[model samples]
Target chain A: GDKVKQSPSALSLQEGTNSALRCNFSIAATTVQWFLQNPRGSLINLFYLVPGTKENGRLKSAFDSKESYSTLHIRDAQLEDSGTYFCAAEDSNYQLIWGSGTKLIIKP
Target chain B: GGIITQTPKFLIGQEGQKLTLKCQQNFNHDTMYWYRQDSGKGLRLIYYSITENDLQKGDLSEGYDASREKKSSFSLTVTSAQKNEMAVFLCASSIRTGAGQNTLYFGAGTRLSVL
Candidate 1:
């Protein structure tokens, strides 16, 4: 189990409120990538889905390869948008399955 | 718009010694990766290469030892060093792989400390 599963491991938002981040794939994923591990750790590269949806400025993403799951949405919530939030998946032999993050904390 | 240089961002080994980590990429990517972040646990894919010298082995890849030698460089070696062995070693690059182009470009990690 847990080929890739991320959820409210941590989140605090406030600045402008509105948040959502998730990833759930047990395999069979086609493609999904979303990252943002700022806070000096640098790992930025949000959204790279394949199933559908994709935005930018305020962030918005969604990928549902037959419900394998994948979603990340955050609007207005700034403070530089906090940190930690990863979701990676790419099965079908492409390999790449990682999810154990979601620590955003945009206060003030 | 390409830069993935990771080297001694901070690394200190001792326990058993033998450590080496270095990655350089100026785009010219062909596929290169080596992840291993272990705090909250997630990124794990010991090695990968798809061009110069090619070599692939993920899922932790044993004691670890990788080298791509060319195409912009990629090297990782930590044969021993294991004593608490803190983690944080990520180096990625993608520009040639199947579908979607496997977009991945990261490098700003290499915080190992195994005193």
Candidate 2:
């Protein structure tokens, strides 16, 4: 069984549209982190949450430790937002359990 | 803002050859980690260091060695490269915010291919 499961293995959306990505965890996660891996393979940190919601620019993220899930929402998606999104949960042991990731393509 | 730098953006090796990857961080983070990502797959941890001279093995630690000789640098060595093996090696560093909680920042990654 996967400790961390991500939804919508792939997603394609038009520019300026809004969409959401999610991660469900079967482990006891204490914290969660979201990242976007650019085409060049550089991972850009999006948010770090501790059982709450955070918003930055056009991105918003929320983590509910009790519910064992996390969500990332993108508003007015831009072409530069096309990339792979990954979320990792820090377990009780402090080990990061990673999700398979969601490949997002923003079409013009 | 700080950065994490991984050397040799690309690496090619022969089967059974020993290969090494290096990472340097300017964030002054106390913890560093190494992860391997195969094509179309999630990342698997290789090794992590909490501090200088302190090493911890992750699930995929077998056949790999790591060193944290200095606070700002961590390195990973593949004992024996497998033919046709291909993966991206990522290096990350994090600072602890609270008890058992951390946020990781990663480098551009190193692409490895073995022939």
Best by lDDT: 2
- lDDT (Cα, tens digit) per residue for candidate 1, span A15-90: 9989998888888998889998988888988878889999998988989899889889999898998989999998
TM-score of chain A of 2: 0.98
The candidate that wins on TM-score is: 2
Please write out the lDDT profile of model 2 over residues A1-108, one tens digit for every residue: 889999989999999999999999999998899989888888888988889999999999999998999999999999999999999998888889999999999999
Which pairs in model 1 have colliding backbones? Answer: none
Per-candidate TM-scores read 0.33, 0.97
Question: lDDT per residue, candidate 1, B1-115, as tens digits?
Answer: 9899999899999998889999999999898999999876668899999889999999899998999999899999999999988999999988844555588989998999998
What stretches of model 1 exceed 4 Å from their correct place?
A1-14, A17-29, A33-50, A54-59, A63-73, A78-81, A97-107, B1-14, B17-35, B38-42, B47-79, B82-85, B88-112
Error at A19, model 1, angstroms: 11
Screening candidate 2 with a backbone cut-off below 3 angstroms (N, C-alpha, C), the clashing residue pairs are none
Total clashing residue pairs per candidate?
Answer: 0, 0
Q: Write the per-residue lDDT of candidate 2 for residues B21-81, one digit (tens) a residue.
A: 9999999999999999998888999999999999999999999999998999999999999
Best by DockQ: 2
